[model samples]
Target: MPDIREENKDIINCVLESMQGFVVTDLDGKIIFLNDRYADILQVDRHEVIGKDVIDVIPGTRMHIVARTGREEMGSLFKLKNGESVLVNRIPVRKNGKIIGVAAFGSLSMLDEMSTVATIQKIGHLSQELNQYKSELNKLRGAKYSLDQIIGNSPNLIKMKELIKKVAQTKSTVLITGETGTGKELVAHAIHQLSTRSHHSFGRLNCAAIPNDLLESELFGYEEGAFTGAKKGGKIGKFELANCGTLLLDEINQMPLYFQSKLLRVIQEKEIERVGGNKPIDIDVRLIFTTNRNLLDMVHQDSFREDLYYRINVMSIEVPPLRTRVDDIPFLVEHFISKINKELGLNITGIDDKVIELFQTYYWPGNIREMENTIERAANLALQGKLTLELFEHFLLRKEKERSRNENEICLETVRFKAEKETIIRVLAQTNANVSMAAKLLKINRSVLYEKIKKYDIRTM
Candidate 1:
C-alpha cells in the first residue's frame, strides 16, 4: 500500500487533463498557468513559462499587444518548433469590470485534444462559481516523463528500468504491477516518452477515482447533449485525444465488469464509438494498465475478466516495493532530499548514516511516495545541521508503537480493512445514512463513499 495521501492525490487530477493547453498572463503579460500540454507544444516547461514574459518565451506573440489594448484576439496561428501550428484565441480576463489577466484558448474544434478550450467558456459562463462545480484541473497533467526521472540504484530498480526501456519500443499493451507509490505512473510516462508516439498527447483516467456511471463517457466520449447534463457541442474521449499517443488506465483492476467488455471491444477493434454516436472513430493508442491488486487472483475469483486480463498482460512488469529494496533507500533519500531542497529553496544536507539505517530497517508500505512525503515532513522540522535520528522521532516513535501493535494487529491487510470499516461506519452513522453528507464530512467523493459503505457491509443506522 502506498501512502494514503499519495493515493488520494489522484482525486486532484482533472478528468480532461492535457486535452487543451492554455496560458494566463497578468495585465503585463507575465505567463501563469501553463498546462503541461501547451508546455510540450511550445517546447518549454511550466517553470520557464510561468512568470516569464510572453514575447521573451514566444517571440512575436501578440498576447502582450492584446493585453495592453484590452481587446480579444481569435484565430491566431502560431508555428511551433515541431512545425505543427496551433490555433489560438486570446481574451481578456475581467475582475469587477477591470481587466486583470489574459487567457489564451487553443481551437478545440481543430485539435483532437480539446482539453483547455472548454475551460475558459465554462469559466465565462459560470464566473467564480466554476470551481464549485468541478475538481481541480490537473496541475501536472499527464506529461511524458523520461526514465531519467526515476531515482534508484538497486538491482531490482535497474532491472525494472531496463525492462521498461525494452518494452517501450513495442506497441504491446503493458500491465504494471506494484504496490501503491511504487512509481508505476512515472514508469508509464517513461515508456511513452521513449516510444514513437512521444510527440502526441498523454491522458490518464483513474479507474477507482471516477464514478462507475461516468467512466464510459469519459473514456469513449459522448455526443452533443448525449445526456441530460452533458456539456454542449459534445466532448472528446481520452482514447480519441490520446489516439496517436498513450492513455494510462491507473488502477485498472477497479474498472467495473460492465465496462470491461466494452473496453475489450474497443481494444480489439482499435476504434471507439461515442456514448450516443453510431459512428466508430479509429484510434491508435498505447495502452498501459496499472494495478496494486493481483489481476490473476481476481481472474481466479471471477472478479476480473479473463480475456481482458490476457489482453493487458501481453507485457507485464512487477516493480519491487521500497521495503524490499533496502539497499536503494539511501540513494532514494538523497535524491528526494535534493529535489525537496530545490523545491522549497532550502539548503538542507542529507540524513546521517544512523537515520539511513533506520530508514533501511523500517517497512515502507507506501513505497517511494511515502518516503518522499516523510522526508519532506522531517526536513520541514529540521532546525540546523544534517537530519539525524532525533529529527525523525515522529517516525521512530511510530515504528516503536507499531511494533507493539504488530502482535495484536497481526495481518496488516486485516487491520487496514477493519480500520476502514470502522471509519466509514462512524462517518455514515454521524451523517444519518446520507451518503452525500457522509462523503462531504469525510472529504471524499460521494460515489467513493457509497462504494466503501457497501464494501464494508455497513447498514444505514
Candidate 2:
C-alpha cells in the first residue's frame, strides 16, 4: 500500500505552514499536525492539543466526519467556542484510493479579511509614493552621519560616544533610549556609520508612524496576492532591504503586544517569512531600536513583552536629556547657527553672551530639535548679523519674563506681614484708635497689637 503520509511529509508540512491557519488529523480524528497561526486562531497552545481529538480541540469542527467519509467540506462557516465564526475548508487525505486523514485550512473572519485588504491597498499606495525617493535613498545609503557630527562635549555625551564606538564593533542588538528629541536617532546613525556594515544600506522605520495592521507587512514584507489589493510582484520589507546592514526601529514602544511576540520570534530565528511566502528568508541585518518611553515600565505594565525587553536590552545606551547636559548648549548653538547661516544665505558671525546665557539657563523642553528651530527662526528674521536676544525677543524673552516674575515673588513672611499690617490699620480705624477695643476685635493682646503697630510704623486715627 502507498503511504502518502510518510512519502511526502516534508513537502506537505511546508505547504501547510505557508497557509494562514491549518490543522491535520489522523484516521482516528486525533490532531497530528498544526501550525502557529492555527493555534493563534484557536487561542490555544499547539503543543497541548497535539494527539487530542479534533472535535475536543476545536469547537464545531467536522474534521473527524470528513476523515471517515473521505468527503471534502469547503467554505464552511465554523463557530468557535468564543462565539466567533470563521471560514474553513476541510479535505480528506488519500493514498491508493483510501482515506487516511483530514486537513482543514481556516481564515480570519470575513470582516477582518476585508479590513486587511483595505490596509494592504493603503500601504500599496504609500509604497508607490515612496518609490520616488528610492533613487535618492540609494545614492545616500550609509551616508547618514559620522560620530564627529554628533556635536556635544559634555561628560555624559563623551561617555555615550565612547560607548557607541565600543558597541559599533559588536554584532549584538542595541537599545537606545531617552526623551523625545534627545538625538537618539543620531546615535543610532553614528553607530551604523562606524560599523563594518557601513558599506551596505541603512534603513529606518518609525514604529509609531505605521498603523498596527500594517507593521508586519512593512517589516517582514509580503508576496504577490498576499491579499486582495496587495502590490504586484510584492514589496520588500526593511529586514530584507537592510540585510547585511543595519535597521533602526524608532519609537518602538508603540508596537502592540501581539506583534511583539511575532517580532521576538524573528529576532530569535534570524529569519523571516513573507506574508504569503512559504520559505523563510535568512537575514543578517544588525538591529538598533530607539524609544522615548521607558520599556521596563511598559514591561511591568504588560504593554511590552518581557522576553523581548531582556532580549534587545543585552546592550543599551541612554542618551542624556538636554536639561541634564546643558553644558552642550553653547556648542550646539554655535553648530546650529553656522548650519542655519549657510542654509539661509546669511552671515551670523556670533551670538550675544546674554542670549547664550539665556539658552544655558532655559529649560529645553524640546531639546536639540527645538534649539535648531529657534536658531533657524531667528536666523530667518536677522538675514545677517550677530544673533541676539532681540531676535528671539518674541519667544525666548518669555524665559526672561518668567525669571523676573520668579525673582519678584513674595515670601510667606512678607505676605503675612502685609496682611497683618493692613488688618491692624483697618481695625484701629474702626475703633477710632481705641487700642484696647481694637486689640479685642483683632483677637490679640493690646500690648502685642501696640508693638505690631509700632513695628509697622502705622499711625492710628
Per-candidate alpha-carbon RMSD to the true structure: 22.9, 23.4
Cα error of candidate 2 at position 44, Å:
73
Q: Residues 1-461, candidate 1: write the lDDT tens digits.
A: 67888766665345224455577788998997777776776778778667888878776677886776677988665555455555678899999999998888667433445564465445445644544433233224446468998877789889999999899888999999999999999999999888766656779989999999999899999999799989898999999988888999999999999999999998899999998999999999999999999997787567899999999999999989998899988888888888888888777877899988888887787889988888888888883358877778788887788677765667777889999899888887887888888888888766667667788888885
- Model 2 spans with C-alpha error above 4 angstroms: 1-138, 397-461
Q: Highest lDDT: which candidate?
A: 2
Question: 198-298, model 2: which lDDT tens digit per residue?
Answer: 76789999999999999999999999999889999998998999999999999889989999998899899999999999999999989999989989767
